[model samples]
Target: MDVRLLEKEGFAGLFMRLRAEGLADKPLLAALEQTPRTLFVSAAHADAAYQDRLLPIDCGGFAESADLVARLLSLLSLEPGQRFLDVGTGSGFLAAVAARMVERVVTVDRYKTLVQLAQQRFAHLGIGNVIARQADGLKGMSGEGAFDRIIATCAFDSMPRAFVEQLASGGVMLAPILAEDGRARMARLTKIGSRFEREDLFEVPYRPFIPGLAAAL
Candidate 1:
């Protein structure tokens, strides 16, 4: 798909809608404008890349919509020179976006193929600040230590302690937490010294958070 056409006909409307809903800002919109969603998905889905919906990707994973990603990034309050951790990297879309806003991004996925694809995507985009790895996201990347911001693209029954521990003081994390009523709610956690304050952002549907590393390609 042509980049100009995608921006003019697709992303422009999406951004306008996000602005109307108070889910977008100047920096976030600029980052989304710079990153083409088409480059992150397979060619078959390229036409739908800019649409405000999730697109299925490899390993039964789904690329989140631009709106959701924008909202998550806005909530994270990312700043330049901050470190970021992206769980369930999927197509590396979120990581790529975060990399543009932060100094470094460490993105983890359980599927090897997904990680490989994410790495390739990062390279193709000339994104040097993102480190894509294949590992159990539930375990988190301890080696990376604390991060200024963390975001999970998948839904989990509960927030993992590892993720909480990896957040630097005053850091923020956004994830989809499954509630007792069988609904997933977008939750935000902020690490304040030794305590983590939780806030429910909104209700949204997302793929379940799978634990452990995948054995298959």
Candidate 2:
């Protein structure tokens, strides 16, 4: 077997387990397969990109694991032509994967370096529908409201009021909400008739949404 083909199979085999574990939504899987995880992380961590563990990214933050990211997305009922908003753009990996599954994705981060790095990765992949910028994300991108879907890569004690308000009527949001004990649990919120129905999904170790942009990083 060719060395490159063997490497390809190895990576494919790792992702296959996600299918067996029931994270096998077709469009989500296709998005994952389409984006190369290695492009989102530094070369030192490229070899571990397919593993289910958070990887350190620039600006002293971490990117959620590929497994967790896939699982979180699998829970989202993603559809084509839906406008998506991603908060806490960290490595931009989540936004990159999602850009493949939706019409347009606007991702925000607190660090300028992270945004720039993610933008480069998106361009390298020829992904054009993502609008990444440096922002606090507590209020989401100004004037980008009423999105079809919203996802926050970090955890919040409660769904930011602004985010829920920004979700279009009948739209869905996937985020991590902190429990009393401070562990973050995945929560799914659906906008219905000006009210949101919340469903706590599962426990996760995602970091909190840092409140401000880096002044000098």
Candidate 3:
């Protein structure tokens, strides 16, 4: 068997499945194949790294599946020379995958443990463009300048007004929003001048966004 083909067999299978379901795009597939998801997978659940399943990480959080990550990223339509903000660094798998496609990435997580672990992964993998820090993502981090694209890994009710306002004009944000009716769905908000165009996408099973930073854990 060809070694290159063997390396892609993992997400490569997922890439084809997502493509058939209209979820995968070519560039994202390439990026996924290049990124080592195993490095970010929690040791206890490393088996799910490239298996199209959410991996259980530390601090009771979950790392989204490669397919879900690719689907959300495709919605962002990321471009070169773009500064992206990732809310909820988690295991930093998504941020690592994204770093290859953008100019820079600022990813924030509430848990200090997650932040420290993720930073170590980024350094081990030689991923320098991502800035992983512990912060309150609900309010958005300040002094980072404007972002061309942003993505939240968790679910929220209503909109993240602070993050919406921080986007550069014409910037795009991808997040999962929950409604009062108990229905939750993914949404893409594109900022055009002073207003935002909200487009709700598929239903998702993401953890609700928590406010404030983790005092411990």
Candidate 4:
């Protein structure tokens, strides 16, 4: 078999497991298959890109694992033509997937280097619908206005008010909520009128949400 085809099959098998585990559905799997995970990680970690695990990227952050990302996407209930907001862009893997599934994606990250790298990756993939920016994700992207779906890759002690306020009516937001015991639970919030209905999806492990922009790249 050709080397590239073999590698593609390996990644496909991982997505198959994700589907069997109920972490991904047909649309999500198709999107994952389309986006090359290796493009979103450092070249040194390219060999492990197909594994269902997080890989370190620029700055001190790590790219989220495929399973975790799939779970988040599943929670969003994304639809075509919807605008998506991705907080904590990291390596921009999630944002890239969102761009493929939705009409547009506005992703924000605290690290300038990650933002730049993500933009380059989006360009290389011919993904024009994704807008990458460097910002304090906890504050939310007020300038972009409301979004149909909002997803934060980091864990916060409590849901940020800005995220809640920026969600469009009937929109959904998913993030990991941290607790005093050092445990994090995946929470999904749906905006109904002016009120938000919250539901705990499951437990997850994620990096702490940092406030403000990073001082250095």
Question: After superposition, which runs of candidate 4 have C-alpha atoms over 4 Å from their true positions?
Answer: 1-3
Ranking the candidates on lDDT from highest down gives: 1, 4, 3, 2
Candidate no. 1 TM-score: 0.94
Q: Report the lDDT tens digits of candidate 3 across residue range 69-141.
A: 8888888887779999999999898899889899999999999999999999999979899999899888777
> Of the pair 1 and 3, which is ahead by lDDT?
1
Q: Please give the CA lDDT of all the candidate structures.
A: 0.84, 0.83, 0.83, 0.84
Residue pairs in candidate 1 whose N, alpha carbon or C atoms collide under 3 angstroms: none
Supply the global lDDT for candidate 1.
0.84
Candidate 2 lDDT score at position 134: 87
Model 2, position 208, has a per-residue lDDT of 69
Most TM-score-accurate candidate: 1
| Per-prediction TM-score to the true structure, in the order listed | 0.94, 0.93, 0.92, 0.93
Total clashing pairs in model 2? 0
- Positional deviation of residue 68's Cα in model 1 after best superposition, in angstroms: 1.0
Model 1 stretches astray by more than 4 angstroms: 1-3
lDDT of 1 at 71: 78
- Model 2 over residues 1-217: C-alpha lDDT tens digits? 4434533764597578897797668788778877887778787877777777888988889887878888877777778898999988888888988889889999998899999999999999999999999898876776875799888877887766667678888998887888788899888899888778898888888876678888986
Tens digit per residue, CA lDDT, model 4, 1-217: 4446645976777778786886747788788888888788776877777777778888988887877787789778888999999998988889988888999999999999999999999999999999999898887799787899998888888866667779888999887899888888888888988877889888776878878989978
